[model samples]
Target: MAGASSRGGGDVAAAALRRCTATAIHSGADPAWSSRLTRPRERDGMVVVYGDARRRLERRATDGAPAVLRRSTAEEEEETRKKVTGGNGEKGEREWRVNVPVVGGHAGITIVPLFSQAVPKANLADEDIKAPTKRTQDGGTKVVQAKAGKGSATLSMAYAGALFADACLKDLNGVPDVVECSFVQSSITELPFFASKVKLGKNGVEEVLELGPMSDFEKQGLESLILELKSSIEKGIKFGNQ
Candidate 1:
């Protein structure tokens, strides 16, 4: 189910998951199979998925960067330069659409964006980073506020879901180097399920990438988010058991 953040949508998605689990049980299949992809909107799954994809597709042109970097189109290059330089050789308000690597859990303060690792290298001041970081964490709330109780960010969420689904499909089809961030059964952290970049392959998550060199701010954000993320994961497990 796409855009399952709303209460009604979330209920439907949960029911669907339960049904899938039930079917797996009946068929003597492992319900905890890694090949299964559950897009839970309660956790902002698509946001990180699409964000990672954008990082790979659009923001990969830095010299001496990782393999994720690529030669971007001229337009993309211009946009990145403009956004980072503010078109006047002075750092300004960083554009929200830039390729930002979001980590941690998918809710509130747990939604940590490593702006220090943002592509095109937006050298934003510490004061300037605070606003966008908060905005990233409160993205859903901002949408609700902007809509005045009318609706949530359904359209954008749907688009993100589509992008994630496509990436999964491409990986399943034997595409190489198909890496995207996902909340999966992980050993990268103490948490059983944590969001991080993972290499997709025919067998699903082939490898979970490490959280490469983080700035002090990102490290602190990760540290602060762990407790809340652990609490949320525990709660979800408790609810699922019930």
Candidate 2:
């Protein structure tokens, strides 16, 4: 369930949690909100899974593994250097038609999708590849605009939550090869907690997978996102502990 407000939501969720004995799975937009909500539960010795929806969508796209990498084409490289364009020099279509490996936190600029490292090797031009990356980053805003601001991303958030929950159930049932990305206490990066592809098991996180091969574009994204991601993570840790 979504947390109402950072403080109120945390208090409510924490109180409600004391009444149950279930593994906690948090699905919300704000990492700080989720951090505030899940921290007390974790402190109480409950298993907690915390990842906002956008990052979970990325996990679903990648099929829960760090995809095999391939070298980017020259055209792709050129497009990465500038704004993507079509052959006629007009705006292109919006489509993320490949399994792009996404990492980092679920927020603007921090949501890093590795389009160049997409599996099955998308033959799309670099300009086209950027389409999905931008869309993925702005997906929530797009929904809000389409709704004319009457509502937020209610349905999509529900779907993302169900998807993660399903993966958890499969792993708990001993279903072989159940992998999903989640934000947990991770050593994958320098951050105390990070979102990355993780293998799920009966005991919870079986293994946190390594980020596989990436292109120069993806490498740059990784470096750029880390700073912001670190700040956001530190903010959450501080707020949660408070």
Candidate 3:
């Protein structure tokens, strides 16, 4: 499935979906952030998963979708981590998996990564976790800086968009247990729309998984983020209604 990042495309796309009864899976940063309106009546058919490609890579590692199949061993994960960040020869020095269960909205503070729950397990100090959390929050800015303010994170976002779209299509075509993190109208949190791991099927979002267990740091992060995420969702809803 092709993806576009044009403004108001969600409006046009949703209008088309209403007419043709077609489903949509979106990963545009703006559209996914504002999915309540982008896919108003889609029910389970509208899937929104947008943000860092790193996050998607992490999810794919654990979900056993393709490429690497079984979960990455600590050593392998460390190597992969070094490759992504250009870390200075830290492969054998440390071992950790990229198991970030990102949630909430797709913006700073709103984007909550559950490093505490990461598998193969991350034996990181609070400072280490804090650094990645902030990095995830400001990932877009780093891209924008690298581009010299010419364009946003088009390439990475597109890759992430296609990845999510492929997963949705696979689920629609009867692939079982197709799960991914997405922002959707949910009761999992107090907010009307939140991003979390969702099970996909022919019908769409078959299930919205809970946030499960979190470390004290993660819990604090979640609490601090809720207000901002709620405001973002409210803003999207207000704009959509207009």
Which has the greatest TM-score?
3
lDDT comparison, 1 vs 2, better candidate: 1
Q: Model 1, poorest ten-residue lDDT window?
A: 21-30
Task: Indicate the worst ten consecutive residues by lDDT in candidate 3.
Answer: 71-80
Candidate 1 lDDT by residue in tens digits, 95-170: 5455655677766667767667676677665666676667666665566567665555444444444455566667
RMSD of each: 14.1, 12.3, 11.7
lDDT of 2 by residue, 1-242 (tens): 22222233444544443333223333334323322332434422211232233233333323323341111011011111121222112333233332445677665566666655554355555566555667666665565567664554555555555566667667766798886656667887777766667788776778999877766666676687888778766766655564
Off by over 4 Å in 3: 1-97
Better of 2 and 3 by lDDT: 3
Clash statistics: count for each candidate = 1, 0, 0
Q: Order of candidates by TM-score, top first?
A: 3, 2, 1
| Candidate 3 clashing pairs, residues 3+ apart or interchain | none
TM-score list, all predictions = 0.61, 0.61, 0.65
State the lDDT of candidate 3 residue by residue for 1-242, as single tens digits: 22223344555433333322222333334433323332334411222223232234334333322332211111011111111121111433232234456777665677777766655356665666776777767766566667664555555565555556667668757899997777788998788987778898877788999899887777788889888777666755654454
- Residue 227's C-alpha lDDT in candidate 1? 89
lDDT of 3 at 144: 60
- Candidate 1 local Cα displacement, residue 36, angstroms: 30
Q: Which ten residues in a row have the lowest lDDT in candidate 2?
A: 69-78
